[model samples]
Target: MTDVRILGTGAYVPERVVSNDEVAAAAGVDDAWITAKTGIRERRWAAGDQATSDLAAAAGRAALRSAGLTAEDLSVIVVATSTPDRPQPPTAAYVQQRLGATGAAAFDVNAVCSGTVFALSAAEGVLGRTGGHALVIGADVYSRILNRADRRTVILFGDGAGAVVLGASGGQGPRVRHVALHSFGDLSGLIEVPAGGSRMPVDETVLDEGLQYFTMDGRGVRDFVGDHLPRLVKGFLHDCGVTPDDIAHFVPHQANGVMLDSVFAGLDLPRATMHRTLTHYGNTGAASLPITLDSAARAGAFTPGDLILMAGFGGGMAAGFALVEW
Candidate 1:
């Protein structure tokens, strides 16, 4: 049986770091209050001219370099992002072109913060069927659509990109074991950008209403995390024929520190068992999970034969989980 091993991983964050103080200055909030609430001290934001595709391309190039392969060797590209260069180009094609990749099918995916895991599952399935190598990237420039005047949303987002190269390998290499994805569109209103999609195209009214900005029912998000994450993790582990004890580490979407802490407390798991990156990255939306995983891997956090549980929950009321061996 062919296995899809992560050959290499890479991430790119813009050089500019936006500190809590800077955010507070812009938003009329205090640094202490923000830190105590979200555990975010700083985050990276792209230069004004940079777009999501630029970040994705940079990460993709690094991933290919780390794998000792060129873009030509890639058989597919899947870019997970809510913010694309244009509403139509899919963004993946631009990354593919930037990398000089040819003949590799490419497209975009949207599941908000859960986009990476959902895209990863899709890549694994594609590899399972075709036995081909795939490049999965999560990149977002959330600042573009943010309501700068609204500190609640602007302060919570940043820009970055992370990529992983998944290649078909012999049975000895690590592979995806079990994956699950679910969404409750009924609760989609919990978080959204009201004006961008077909439901409400950008117009004078949208501009007047600030509809393109990120909006969320913070209480709804809090409630969902407090009630849903623990159950999802457990259900995923059960379906994968594993126990919480069997998991070497839990890598979840780095939405907020408070949410993650709550999940740990609810699961009765030691805080040390969960890998986190929200403190430095804030929330990169779809890029959060993959970026955390990449950072952890680079820090030598995993060992051979270790089971890792990955989960994410976000807009679209989306949630997903997967179990894999490192």
Candidate 2:
């Protein structure tokens, strides 16, 4: 079987920085309270004119540049997003146009926060068979869907995009070894946007009820992660024929710093240095994992033969795990 590996990675966050103080005031909390709870000092918010595709395109360009490739060389473009530019067209279509990736088949995947891993899995499979490059992007504009006054959801999210270029393994960069995805529809109610879908169309009543805004049962999500994440990580490692100690780096969804601390402790991966960008970026939904991955790569963190494990868990009550040999 031909191997598929990441040729390059890139990330982009909006210019406008929204400080904890800003969100705290809107959410009726103090900066100290926000910091103590989320460990998020600030996060970026998209400008008035920027949409999810714009961020995705910028990141894709950077990734293409990193790979020394061009958009014309791409055969596939997959964008994983929950907050798209519009409900009609897939965000990847816009991204494809922006990047001039006319040769690529463009589409979108809505796995919520676990989206990057899912997109990577899809892109890798496509490239493995087609023998060409694919651009996988995870982007979200949570600010557009958020209720500024809702402390439960608003303060925990930021807008950003991250991307990776994957191609036939050339003994350079990280080669993808294994990928696993799991979804729990039974727990889907734990996090949601109550309206705007067919089940509950956006009417005046829905707007009055603030049903369009993002909402979550924080405690329930915490419990779900506590119960499932560690076991999933262990099982995935076993399936990949690797032990926890073999992992040199672990990048997880930047959901909540407090929750991540708890999950990290339970995983028992002593040798793995957990990489986190949440302190500065907060929870970037689908963009979290890849954004952090790009940051680490740019910082010269990975070495040859190092095993990197990435795990993403979020709103679909879904989880995705991928193992990459660096």
**Highest lDDT scorer:** 2
TM-score of each: 0.96, 0.98
Worst 10 residues of 2 by lDDT: 167-176
TM-score of 2: 0.98
What is the lDDT of every predicted structure here? 0.85, 0.93
Model 1 misplacement above 4 A: 270-272
Q: Over all chains combined, what TM-score does candidate 1 have?
A: 0.96
- The residue-by-residue lDDT of candidate 2 on 1-326, one tens digit each, is 46888899999999999999998888999889998999899999999999999999999999999999999999999999999998879999999999988999999999999999999888877887888999999999999989999899888999999999999755677898999999999999999988988999999999998899899999999999999999999999999999988999999999999999999999999999999999999999999999999999999899989999999999889999999998
Tell how far residue 108 is off in model 2, in angstroms. Answer: 0.2
Residue pairs with backbone overlap in model 1:
none
Error of 1 at 178 (Å): 1.3
